[model samples]
Target: MHPIAQPRRRQLLQAAALGVAVLSTGCASVSTAARPRVVVVGGGWGGLGAVRGLLATAAADVTLVEPNEAFMSCPLSAHFIAGHQPATDFQRSYSRVDQLGARRVRERVLEIDRTSKMVVTATQRLPYDFLVLSPGVDYMEDGIQGYAEARAQLPVGFRAFEQMAVRQQVDEFLAKGGDFVISAPKPPYRCPPAPYERAFLIAEQMKQRGTKGKIILIDANPNPMPPAIAQPILKGMKGLYANQIEYLTDTSISAVDMGKRQLVTSSGDVPFAHANLILPMRAPALIRQAGLGERWANIRLPSFQSQVDDRIYVIGDSQGTPLPKSGHVAFGSGQRVAEAITERIAGKSPVVSTGAVDLPLGICWANVTHKEAININVSGTVVAGEPPKLKFTVDAEANARSGAAAVSWGNGMWKAMLG
Candidate 1:
C-alpha cells in the first residue's frame, strides 16, 4: 500500500459514509425527481470509475454517453497486440455498469453546449447540471508526413480496439522477417512507454520463433519516458534483445513512405515490412469544441473541475496535467471527481486543505518480457495554492515479482471499472 493511501483511508471512509447518507436521503425525495443530472462522456477507465462511483451514491441522474457499447483497455493490451493473449482478455461488456443503475447512452458526443448545460449528440441533446469528460486521446497525424493518407497501412495501436490492425501487421512481420518499425512520441502523450512495451512483447515472440527480423525503435525523446525507468528499459533492450532490436533515440519520423514501406527520419531513411507508428496525441476535438482547452482540458488541481466551466470536470488522459497518462491515475482521478461533485451537491462548500494534500499515486509498469517487468509508482502532493509536486519510486531492475503483480493489477483494475 502507498504511504499516502493508508493515511488518507480515514478521510476516504468518511467520504464514503457521506455519499451513502446523501443517497439514502435522496430516496425519500423520489428516485431522481430532485437529483441533479451528471453526464459522463466516454466509457473508458476514467468514465467508468466516475459512473460506478456516481451510481453508488445515487446523488445524480447519471447518463454515461459513450460511442462504444463495450469497453476495451488500452493499457496491458500489448499482450493482445503481440498475439500472446486474445482480444477478449482485455475487453469487458458494459452490462455490469448498466446493471448498476446507470443509463448507458450509446452515442458519440458531438458538442458541449456550456451555456445551455446540454451535451449535443447526433440524435439527441442531453442536458446536465454537471458534466464529466473523459474522452481519451486523439493522434497528431500531421507530425508524420503522408501518415494521414497511409493510416490503414500504418496502424498506431495506442488506442483501444485499434490493436487488431497493428496485430495483423505484427503477425505479417513475424512470419516474413524484415524491419518492423515502432516509433515512440515525446511526453504528454498517452502511455509514454507503450510503444516500447509493444516492441518488447513482439521482440519476445521474434526470439522464441527465431524470426529473421529486427525491430527499429525510433524514439522522439532522448530516453524512454518518465526518465525513471529508462535505465532498466535500456538495460533490457541492450542485454536481452540486442540481436533483435535496433534502438534509435532523439529521432522523429518526419514522413511515412508507405509506397515503399520506408519511414523518412532525421537520422536516415528506415525501411519496414510492417510499422506501428505511435504518433503524438492530444485530447479529443470534443474538448476544444467545448471550449475546455486546446490540446487538453484545463483542469483545476485536486478537484479536476474545469478552469473555464465550474460544472464540467475532466479526468483521464484528456486532462492537461503533469500526471502520467496511466489508467491507474485516470481511474483514481475519476473517483476523486465523483467525491468532489457529491460533496458539492451535499451543500458542503469547497474547503481547501492548508497543508500538503496527497494526490493519487500513478502505478505504472513496463514489461521487459511477458514474465518480467519494471514497476514505476509516482506519488504526488500539492499545497493549497502551489503546483503539485511529483516523486517517482521505480524498481531497480526488471523482476518477475513486478511482472506478476502487473497482471494482478490489470485484472483488479478491470474488475473495478467494469464489474
Candidate 2:
C-alpha cells in the first residue's frame, strides 16, 4: 500500500464518528427537511467516483449531468485505437449510477451560474446546493495553423469516443503502408505517456503485419513525460520498434498544411500519409465561462474547492493542480471531495490537517505491446500552505506482469464505477 493512503484511513474513521453525532443530535430537523442537492458534471472516472462516494453517504441528492448516456474510459482505449480491441471494451452504461439514485441528465452543460447555484443546459437549469465539475478537456486547435479547418483529418483520441476515429485512421494506415505521423504535445496533457503508448501499440501491429511504413513519433518534450519513466519508455521504443518507429525529440508542430499533408514543425515540414495531431489541451470552455481559471480551474489543495467559488469543487484533469492528470488521481480526488461535502452537510467544518498530509495517488500504465506494459505510480504529500511534494515509482522496462495487471485494474475500476 502507498504511504499516502494511511492517514486518509484515519481521517475516514474520524468523519464517521462526526457524521453519527450530527444525525443523533438533530434527527427531527433533518428528517423533515429536503435533502441537499449535489450536482456533478461529467460522467467519466472522476464524476463516477464522486457519484459513488456521494451515494454511499445517503446524505445528498446527487444529480449527474453528462452529455453522454454511457461512461467510456480513456485509459485503456489505446488498445482500441491500435485496433487490438473493440471500443466497446472500454465503454459502460450509466445504468448503475441511475440505480444508485443519481439523477442522470444526458445533456451538455451550457453554463454554471455560481451566484444562482444552478447548472444551465440548453433546455433547462438544475439548481444545486453544491457543484462538482469534472468536464475533462478540450484540444487547443488554434495551437497549430490550419488545424481548425483540417480537424477532420487529425483526431487526438484523448477523450472518450474519439479513440474510434483514431482507430479508423490506424486501420487505414495498416492497410496502406506509408508515413503515419503521431505527435505528442507538451506536458500537463491528459495522461502524459498516452501518445507514446499509442505509438508503441501501433508499432507492434506494424511489426506483426509486416506493414511497409514507419511511425514518425514527434515528441515535443525531450524525453517521456514526468521524467521518471523516460529511460524505460525510450529503452522499450528503441529495443522493440527500432525498425518500425522513427522518434524525433524536441520537435514541436507549428502548423499543418492539409493540402500537402505536411506538418510544419520547429524541426521542419514533414509530409505524412496519415496524421494524428495530439494538439495541446486545456480545461473545457465551461471552466473559463464560469471564471474558474484560465488554463484550468484554480482549486484549493486537500479540499479541491474552487478558489473563486466556495460552493463549487473541481476535480479530475480540469483542476489546475501539480498532481498528475490521471484517472486514478481524478477518482481519488473525487472521493476526497465527497468526504469534504458530507462533512459540510453534517454541520461540521472540514478537518484541517497541519504538517504533512497525503494527496491522491496516481497509477498509470504505458502498454508497449498487446501483452507488455510499464507501470508508473505517483504518491504525494503536502503542507498547509505549500505546493505538494510528489514521488514517482515507474517500472524500469515493459513486462508481461504489469500488462496483465493493467487489464485487471481496468476491469476492477470499471466495475467500481459502473457495475
Candidate 3:
C-alpha cells in the first residue's frame, strides 16, 4: 500500500477494535467473539447504502434480505419506459455486495418479529441486533376504480423491473399513436419530475415517428410539482412539444374503464388509446405490518430511528419526512443510519446537537428530450424540535449540459452502489 493510504488503514483497524471491544462488554447477541448482526431489508438504493456502510466498518456481519436476485434502479428508468434505452443499462447484480462479506438472502420478508428481534421470511427467521428497513414504496392500487382489474394494461413502472412492462406500452404507443394519456399523481410519491419526463421523451418520439395523436397529460397538482421547477418543466413541454401533448392541470383520475379505454376524472370521462396511470404511493405492506407507521414509516429525522423502536431505522421514500423522495436522499440517509448504529455498538451515543444539523442533499433530473434536461437540487437543515427546512436550486431551463450531467451522474451513482 502507498504511504498516504496508511492512515486510513490504521483508522479502520481502530474502528473495528472499538466496535468489538465495546460490544463484548455486554449485548450478548453481538460481541467481540461474534460480529454484530445487522439485517438490511431491500437491496435497492437505500438498503445497499446501509449494507455497504456497515460492511466498511468490519464491525457488523451484514445480512441483506431481498427477494430479487439482482438490483435494478428506479432512478433514470424513464429512459427505458420511453424506449430510449434498455433495462439492462440500469440493472446490476448484487454479487459485488455478497463478495464484500455480506450474506445475501434471496427471500421476501413476510413480517418483522419485534419482540423476538427476528425477520420472518417464508422459510427462515433471520435475527439481528440492528434492523434497517429501506423497503421502498408500494402503489395504492385501490385508489382508482377498475385499476386492480386492469393492472396488466397499465403499469406504473416507478419501481424496479416494472419498467419493462411500461416500456412495452411505450413501444406500442410510438408505433401506433392515438391518444396516449399519462397522469401525474400528487407530490410525496417517488420521483416527482419523472412523470413529466416520461411524457416529454415519448412525445419527442411521436414527433420523430410522425405518430398521429396527442399526449393527454393529466396532472393532479396545478402544475409540475415541487413548484420550484414548474416553470422550467412547463417551458420544456409547451415550447418544444406543444402540439404533441395536451396539458391539463388540477385533473385526477377517479376511475378507469379498461373495456372502453377511458378514465373517469374530476373533469369527466376522458378516453385514450393507451394510458400510464401513476397512482398515489405509500410505504410497502411490510412497513405497516411491522407497525412502523401508517402510509409511511414514522421516523425521527437526523438519526432516522423509528419513533417506537430504537433498534429499527427506516430510510428512503418509506420514511415520512419533508425531504424529496429521490435516490440521492435515500442513499445518504442509509449511510447516516449505518454510522449511527456503528457508534451505538461502540458504546458511543450520536451527538445531540444544540443547533441545526444538515440533512442529506436530494439531486434529481428531468429529461425534456434525449439531449436536453433540467436539474433539481435540494438541501435541508433541521433543529431537534422543528421540521426540516428544504431549499431548492433548479435549472432555469432545459439544456444539453444538464442532460449530459444526468447520464454522468447515473453512471457515477451506479458505480458507488454496485461497482
Number of the top lDDT candidate: 2
| Per-model TM values vs. the true structure | 0.93, 0.93, 0.92
When 2 and 3 are scored with lDDT, the better candidate is 2
Candidate 3 colliding pairs: none
lDDT of model 1 at residue 252? Answer: 81
The residue pairs in collision within model 1 are none
How much lDDT does candidate 2 score? 0.84
**True-vs-predicted CA distance for residue 31, candidate 1, Å:** 16
**What does candidate 1's lDDT look like per residue over 1-419, in tens digits?**
11234355434422321221111111011123477999999899788878877877647889999988788999888988987999999999999988888898899899999989999999999999889999999999988899999988888887778988999998988999999989988888988878888889999999999999799999989998879888988998988899999999999889988888889998999988888888899999999998899998998776777988878889999999898898877787777777666766776555545576666568788888989988888778776567889999898888999999888878878887786
C-alpha positional error of residue 335 in candidate 2 after TM-score superposition, expressed in Å: 0.9
Residue 69 lDDT (model 3):
90
Tens digits of per-residue lDDT, candidate 2, 131-162, equal 99999999999999999999988888898888
Winner on lDDT between 1 and 2 is 2
List the candidates ranked by lDDT, beginning with the highest. Answer: 2, 3, 1
